[model samples]
Target: MERLHHHKVLTTVTWLLSIIISIYYTFEKPHDGVWPRRKIWHQNDKFHTAFRLNSIIASIYWIVLFVLQGGYIAHLFSGTVEHVNAACSVGSHFIVNNLFHFAFVMLFVRSYFGWAELFIILNFFNLSSLYFRHPGYARFIHTPVVSGPLAWTFIAIYWNGAIMVPHPDTLVARIFGNIFIWSILVYGLFFIVVYKDYTMGFNLSVLSAAIGVSQFLRQVVAFQWIFAFVIMAVLFVATLVVAVPAATGRDIKFARARAGDTERAPLLGEN
Candidate 1:
């Protein structure tokens, strides 16, 4: 019990520290002369014109989702509301971390890359703790959010690069790999526009590949593999459905159109 309290305290402190760092980076002005104007301006303009818009929308969506769904979960587990709330809080952490990452990416893609990569490593450690110390909490929290279609969207994006890498040794494998890779990359690119980083996007792709390979080995090593694959396929399709519309909405044309004719305004009183 004492150990659990200590763990919780540690996690809370880490989360607070991360939040502070994220805020600092978001508002901090770039060091003078640290970056060339062309690159920085280009990225900054892109962020202001496109990526920031998408990220704001996505963040709003997740905020609404967490409130509604999290409330429902809380009601269902009324007897263990504290436990459920804790788990839900963890899920919120996941969303917030991604949001911060997107914000960073919008400001500076290169810096975002390194920071996002470090966050992914940190998440692995976080997951380990949830998996072992609070199995029920972890299962309840992750199964619904992380293992579901929404979660898979993130996974697909992460593994996209690996899938795209050619494997001509086997035609069947090649075809499957291409499909998986393309699906992930295309979908991921959409969210990448909104989130402004490729870290979660890349990690999702990696997770997909790992799951695929694991399922394949299970088939050869055990008879129950077929059932597992079938379930995975259903979940994958569901994830596709949930993610595709959002991905399509992020297209440049769609964004520009939705943004309306603000760009047509006269520059420097030329009109």
Candidate 2:
């Protein structure tokens, strides 16, 4: 009776929360300040003659994310469907599935903007995934075992211009893009490995690296040498910063696991 009551309470809370979030995203003014109703972009363009493309892209991206995330939440709580493993499947149904959809959408939208930095921002999803994992939000996001590596690959491609713009000669923009992409990749590798899925991480990392190298080679041969070199340097530094801490943490976790196994083995042998 107690277990059944607990389950019912959990289900009720989940439904209520989902409904609330859905309503908020559907109607509320976005905190990120990119509302379609506002003419901020037009106003800026008229006065400054400088295009704030990143800001515009960021705004649109936020709207898409809000809608998709909201829809996924609604689907989970609709209660019109029944199946075994419904509880376990809820996370995958919305969060993970919608993520790929979201990525594909971003890919198309990014092509219009032609800004590598904007696409690089997509890497933050990995860090967001990791942070959410602590609260079991990973289950809610339906974040897959493959999300982290996939994110890294996306970042790599974005940086190398496979997924975003190759032009615009601004050092500051490139630097910001590099930092954002690298942070996500490093953070992603940590979470993916911690989840005990090294194979996926390794495979994705290698593939992304290969793509990055190939892109770099193409750029260099085409005489876009300065941008390619600078971007590569930024990528190398960012990778080191993000990967080092994650790798160290993984080593400690593995050591602890081995010790526990050794201790348990002796007890079992005595039995």
Quote each prediction's TM-score.
0.34, 0.33
- Report the poorest 10 consecutive residues by lDDT, candidate 1: 262-271
Instruction: Score residue 46 of candidate 2 by CA lDDT.
Output: 22
Kindly list the per-residue Cα lDDT of model 1 for residues 98-139, writing each as its tens digit. Answer: 444344333343434344444444544444443333322332
Residue pairs of candidate 2 with colliding backbone atoms:
91-142, 95-141
User: Which residue segments of model 2 deviate by more than 4 Å?
Assistant: 1-88, 91-131, 134-181, 192-194, 220-271
Model 2 lDDT per residue over 1-271, tens place: 4653454444445444534543443344234423232132332122211111233333443344444445444443455332112332334323333343334333332232333234434444543544344322222232232243244335444433422334333554445544444543454356444443332343334333443443344343422233333434544554455445446764322222123221111100010
Top-lDDT structure, candidate number: 1
lDDT of 1 at 17: 53
Question: What do the candidate models score in CA lDDT, each in turn?
Answer: 0.38, 0.36
Would you give me the overall lDDT of model 1?
A: 0.38
